[model samples]
Structures are given as C-alpha cells and as structure tokens.
Target: MKNIPFISALFTPALIIIILSGCSRIYYAPTTQNVPLLTEQNELRIAAGISGGEEYEAVNIEVAYSPVKYVGIMLNSFHAAENSDSLFTNPVRYKGNLTEAGIGFYYPLATYYTAEVYAGYGKGTAQYPWSFDTIAPLKFDRFFVQFSAGMKRKYFEIALSDRFSYVHYTNIEEMYKIEAFSNYKYVPKNNQLYIFQEPALTMRAGLEAIKFQMQYQICIPFSGPTLGYSSYNFNLGIMLTPSVFFK
Candidate 1:
C-alpha cells in the first residue's frame, strides 16, 4: 500500500502543471485567516503566525487600526515555500515561492461580531523538478469578504470567521512559454479564475494586551475547483492588542 506521503506528493506534479499553466490562481492565493475585532477608536492590533500543510509552509503577518468605532483598516502579507520533504521522487526537488499583500476594511457588527472585505494581489515562481534550474512565474489577484463573531473577556477570547475568496490569474501563456516547464504534461488552458470559501475558529487566552492564539481553518469545497490547495489547515500563534490612544 502507498503511504500518505506518496499520495500527497502525487499532487505536486499536478500543482506544478497548474502553476506553470498560469490559468489557475490557486497557487498564489493567500491561505491565511484574519479575524479583526476593534472595539474603540485608535486601538491597534498586530498578529503573526506560521501555518503548514502537506505541500507548503507559510508565514503570515498583519496590522490593524480602528481610527473610529465604526471603521477600521488593516494590512496583511503572506509568504510561502514548497516543502521538499513532501516530494515523492528522488533527485526531483520541487522549489517554489509565493508572496501576497492585502488591504482590508472592517466594520463592527453589533457588539460581538465584525465584518471585513479585503483585496489582495500576489506573485509566485516555481522550478519544476524536471526543469533543472529554470524557473517560471505565476501572477494572480484576489479579493474576499469575511465575517467574525467573538467574545472578548478579561482573560480570554474566542472568535470564528468565514471568508470567501475570488481569484484571477494573468499571463498564463507566457509562463508556459518559459523554457523550464515547456515539456510538462497536461498543459493547462490560460486565463482562468477560481473561488474559495474558508472558515476558521480561534481561541485566544492571555492578559489585557497580549494573548496566545490557536486557529483551525477549513477550505469549503463548494466554491470552485482547487488544484493546489488542501482541504484543511491549522495555525498557532499570538496577538497583541495594546490600546494606543484615548478617544
């Protein structure tokens, strides 16, 4: 029987094919989960975390500010690299890097809920195992709407967020024309779009300004076809929400 590593590793080729094709935007889309809750004007919060999956490892960081009670702004970034240990074949090392940046708007929903909408763009590069040293580019844009409900207490807080994403790719044909991945199988059609929906639940426990956090995210299967992403992932990290100024 094949081990789980072999099964999971098989997807790499397909992912490599899709990434080089440039039609699917799934490869460069950020997989981080953001839950923003701003209760007062001039409040500032920063979060950082690392997440891992079968094929990739990612680092995420974000900063948010609530200038007024009813409005907030946030910026976030992500960087991911392929995991060489997950590869199935020897001497076939899959190498890739992806980076993303996003800006978002947040609105308070009642007393315990917050809603956010964000737009993001990213770029990626991959070197296929068969391609030796040549690298190919992948470019994409994305946007999402998210909602969160949480309870904030003196000692701890619990939050849950649902995020929906739409991803679009550009210059797919140009990527395929690159010399490195020119001979790969199942070449993809260019200029494609995809959608994804993810929901995450989080728990944070700590003092008034600093907290330890753990979160679980599931990529719902209904939105669109996912060629390069996993169905579920988890993140563990910390958040700092120190009050900046008095209103």
Candidate 2:
C-alpha cells in the first residue's frame, strides 16, 4: 500500500530492461492462455522459470523451480493504491508487485501433478478498506506470515508449470499495533498481527513458461478480489534469475 508509488517508479526501469532483453509486448489487451503449466520429468537437474503481466499499470514477477526436486521456492510482490514512494504527492501512484523469495517442499503428484506446502510473505493490497492502516500507528510497524496450499501441472518435462494459491494474506492493518512506523526512540512491548482476517479471499493463479535451458521465465499474473478499492489487479512481465546463487 505505502509502496505503490515506489513500485510505479519501476516502470521506467522495467521498460529499459524489456528493451534490453529484446522482449516487448504492446499489451493492447490480455493474451495469457489458460494453459497447463506442468512439464514432464526427465532428468536429475535444476530448472527455473518466470512470467509477468500488466495490471494497474504495473508489472509483476513470478518465479518457480526444480532446483533439486524436493526443494523449491516461489515468490510474489505487488502494491496497492497506497504510495510506494515517500515523495509521491498523489500517495496513490500505482500498484506494485514483486516476489522476492520463498522456500517450500514440492511433492511430485501423478507424474503430472505437484503439490506444495507453501508459506510465504509478499506485499499485496486490500480487496476492501479495513481502515486498519487508518486505525492508528501500528499499521507499518508489524509484519506477518501467510500459508497456502497449491497445485501445479508439469510442462513438457521441462521447467514450465502452473499453480494457484487459494489462501491469501489477511489481517491487513493491525493499526492499533503500529507504534513503530513513527520515529520513536523507544519501542512498545505489545505486538499483535494476523496474516489474514477474512473480508475477501485473495486468490491468485499463474502460468510459467521456461525457456533457454531454464535461464529465464515468462510469467503472467492475474488476480481479481471481489472486495475493495482495487477490486482486481492484472499485470504481466518477465523474471530473470541471476547466475549467482546463494546457499
């Protein structure tokens, strides 16, 4: 929410990268095929893929993998109408989404299906205003953890796949608990926050296409929550994996 303005600032940067990557889309409408995402298994190697689409005039990044089979990760990040930048006069620049990193266990199902015990924390928006952010000083002072159960289909025995998170983030604004976003030298002792409080469910589905020996992923992001100021968000873009690996 507070990051919307900052996220919008990335458009210029993303545009430059898109131009440099030689992958550009006019985006007149939407072109995401409701396609199957799983690839057949064939090797004892690692694979990675990414995808993104455009919504709220912002781009999203999706990442997935088979780094070893038993170990994998998925990530997502976005913003609300709230300002992503501190200097934005509008305070509602644009929606921003970015999935930094997530680690989970991937279970291969039916040689075509995969299940995940996925728990992740990514920034997102409210389907409806809970007035939590406006409630008090506790809004920005706390963080949360969320969990999801998902299914994915293998893609042509490669790094491509599709998955959905039926469960979404909740308990958006523990504003009464937000005593830190302020510049106080001393911190409070009471802290209460929930990953979700349930006004509307934030369901998300994604399709991933891995190409170039799993060097990059093309992902399309779509979400339409039936509650709030930003009822639904649709965005698309690509995610690139740095050659360097940590851990």
TM-score of each: 0.71, 0.35
Cα-based lDDT at residue 59, candidate 1: 78
Query: Model 1, 1-247: lDDT tens per residue?
Result: 6588898798978886665444212353236676756666687888888876655567777777776665666776666666544333224444445455555566666765555565555555544333555445555666666677777676687887887777665555654565234332323235556777788898888987788878888876444443455566677788888673343
Write model 2 residue lDDT over 112-178, tens digit each, in one string. 4554444444433332222223332211221223232323332222232233322233343442243
Residue 211, candidate 1: alpha-carbon lDDT: 86
Note the residue pairs that clash in candidate 1. Answer: none
Among the numbered candidates, top lDDT falls to 1
**Backbone atom clashes (below 3 Å) for every candidate:** 0, 51
Which ranges of candidate 2 are over 4 A from the true structure? 1-55, 79-99, 122-231, 235-247
How far in Å is the alpha carbon of 26 misplaced in model 1?
A: 7.5
